[model samples]
Target chain A: MPQHPPPRPGDERTPGRAYSARFHLLDRQIVTEDGTPLAKADDLELIPDSDGSLVVSAVLIGPTALAPRLRGRPARLLNALARRLTTGPTDHHARIAMGHIIRIGAALTATTPPVDATLHPLEDWIRDNVIAPLPGSGHAPG
Target chain B: MRLADLMGARVIDVTGRDIGHVSDVRLTEAAAPSRRLPGLHVAGIVIATRRRSRLLAYDHRPVDAPWPLTALARRATRHALWAPWTAVTAHRRPPRTGEPGTVTLDQTAASLTPLRDMHAHWNSGT
Candidate 1:
């Protein structure tokens, strides 16, 4: 590969704070405006632009994004379970639009509000059918 | 396509020769927004000589640690190649039988930027 020097401090078009996607963004915890932890940014959605380049369209969060990154039988099991539970073969990932990103630091903060945890089918399933019915499960800790 | 789909995909030249694996992606900061959503543009993809199964960001910035930790990271990312998105062709999925996915490059390896030099250039300004 041909070697090219990195951009200097005063170089035009260089970001004020340069960030490598992996170093700065990937797998970061995504929090909402109210500081509620939503999810980790499991994957990125890149949309192709007319100029033959790509732009980060959104940050993907959820099991749909995580299963693919996992290897072996565990991945297979998760894939099977997710497929069986979904309404249909939908885009399983929950996307947080790039526009909602307010800041990027130790953790990412977005304008989007925290999703209701009850909306998670698996969590709902476990709560309604499994946990709620058990004895002494209704009350909170002292 | 999702970043997961591209990460670890095989990079090939016009002649269909194996180049390397997609190691990481590079993004340029989007212009400051005014009542708009902030975003980033994909500038390039980093290709490594080997498939880096583990995720590490040691390659992008310089490290000055106690000892071998820095040395090991430098060696790990020694042969990284930065391929600009402009040189990228179509992102073809279900790449012909043997390939998982293919990152088709418009030009040869000569067009890629070496990682070490990029780090030097980045540090020079600081």
Candidate 2:
């Protein structure tokens, strides 16, 4: 784990410098360094600082992290599915550490490719079983 | 906890007087481990005086707009204030006995920086 930086002197907000997580990061799409879509920032993982403030540790990307934001029936179904699929303590939402993030403009760009099998089980399953078998699916759009 | 959990949480001062509901969290970019990259840290919580009047773009960022819209938005969200995280001393979970939970601040709520002033400070680089 990377060492946490101490709090800055004076106010945290610096004009022309500070970025608001709610306005800039929340609900933004996560993309690879080369711009391939990976996932959305479903939620943020926070670890309590020794000083009592909460520090954002990672960007959470998965239905397990997103279930709280889903509406009534969808929330129930997703929660049930998540519970059924998650097998052990190791099964957790994929988290991209802040250190890996390259930029945070309209979309968040990460220096590293997303870990395979971390957050996109459904997408992987569909591609492998459904789409990959289709005759034209192997080629990119001309 | 999630940002959603904090957004609408009730806020109370050290004296146990109700302040308001948390309308939004005030965040600032933390020093990124690398040059030119951005990381975020929570700076404070924005308290909205009335539950219904949820302040939006007015409190955190400067909104340069057509005169009428700017005036209306500023007037509407005037009661919002940004209380520094230092004032936040504790968080309470919902009571097993059925009372609503609240976030506790160390000082009186009236001393918080008003949103208008925070916006000015945000823009002025102070």
Candidate 3:
């Protein structure tokens, strides 16, 4: 059987030459293993293996992880919002194992199931009582 | 409607209520793999802010004025909608009137519904 290659990071395009990394990945939404929106790539986790070489193990998401990087007032506001929205950021931030990533294109895609999603109480409340209750909750215009 | 045509089209909530004007369209799909597509995807639309600060920032002028949040909430359906076309993820149609105005929620709205104050009963957590 032919061996499949490791996932490729999504495309990176600018007005000029193509380059990729933090700027392209940071703050971008992370897709679920099942193609759902898990969350954004709030930050990158660089874990050093036994050899002392650091490799990206996962994508850290949620406001708590992001607030510190926002700076100044935005950070303060994001921190407060994160505290209100979640049960405080999880100890490790919502982690999406790099293996789950399916491919990279315009945005990152993953085959991993959603760790963070509509399951949240706040999201559920909004979708059910607020979003779903609306006229055409999840339907497209004809 | 053609996205270009809807550029200045008057946008309203599902209930046909006014919120604000359209600012920009957000494309959210990943770029094509084999062939470069200039990174095409219709992810979601970002509506500009209409807060008092934003208004003051505009200084009562239409200087790239941000959109109203109420209008943005309606577009939560763009991704879920999954229509035949993804060229335009969402449209920004600034409401005709200044205030949210009155809109009755019903079948007349097709797939659109008026965005309500979801935070009314709960503490804003602010």
Best by DockQ: 1
Per residue, candidate 2 scores C-alpha lDDT tens digits across B47-105 of 88886766665666766588887787788668887888888888764432123347889
Best by TM-score: 1
Backbone clashes in model 2, listed as residue pairs: none
For TM-score, candidate 2 versus 3, the one ahead is 2
Q: Tens digits of per-residue lDDT for model 1 on A1-142?
A: 2122322334233234456777667888877656667678887888876556677888887676666655556755776677676543455566788877767766677778665542255666777888889999889462
Residue A66 error for model 3, in Å? 2.2
Q: Model 3: per-residue lDDT, tens digit, A1-142?
A: 2122333433322222221233345566566434455567765554433322223456565656566554347766876776776643344355566555545544566666554452244565566677777887679452
Better of 1 and 2 by DockQ: 1
Model 2, runs deviating above 4 Å: A1-16, A69-78, A84-91, A129-142, B32-39, B92-101
Q: Across residues A45-137, which tens digit of lDDT does each residue of candidate 2 receive?
A: 766765567766788877677665554567557766876765444347777886676666667776666565766776676778888999989
Task: List the lowest-lDDT window of 10 residues for candidate 1 chain B.
Answer: B30-39
Cα error, residue B68 of model 1, in Å, equals 2.8
The residue-level lDDT of candidate 3 at A22 comes to 32
**Which DockQ-derived CAPRI band holds candidate 1?**
acceptable
In order, the Cα lDDT scores of the candidates are 0.68, 0.67, 0.38
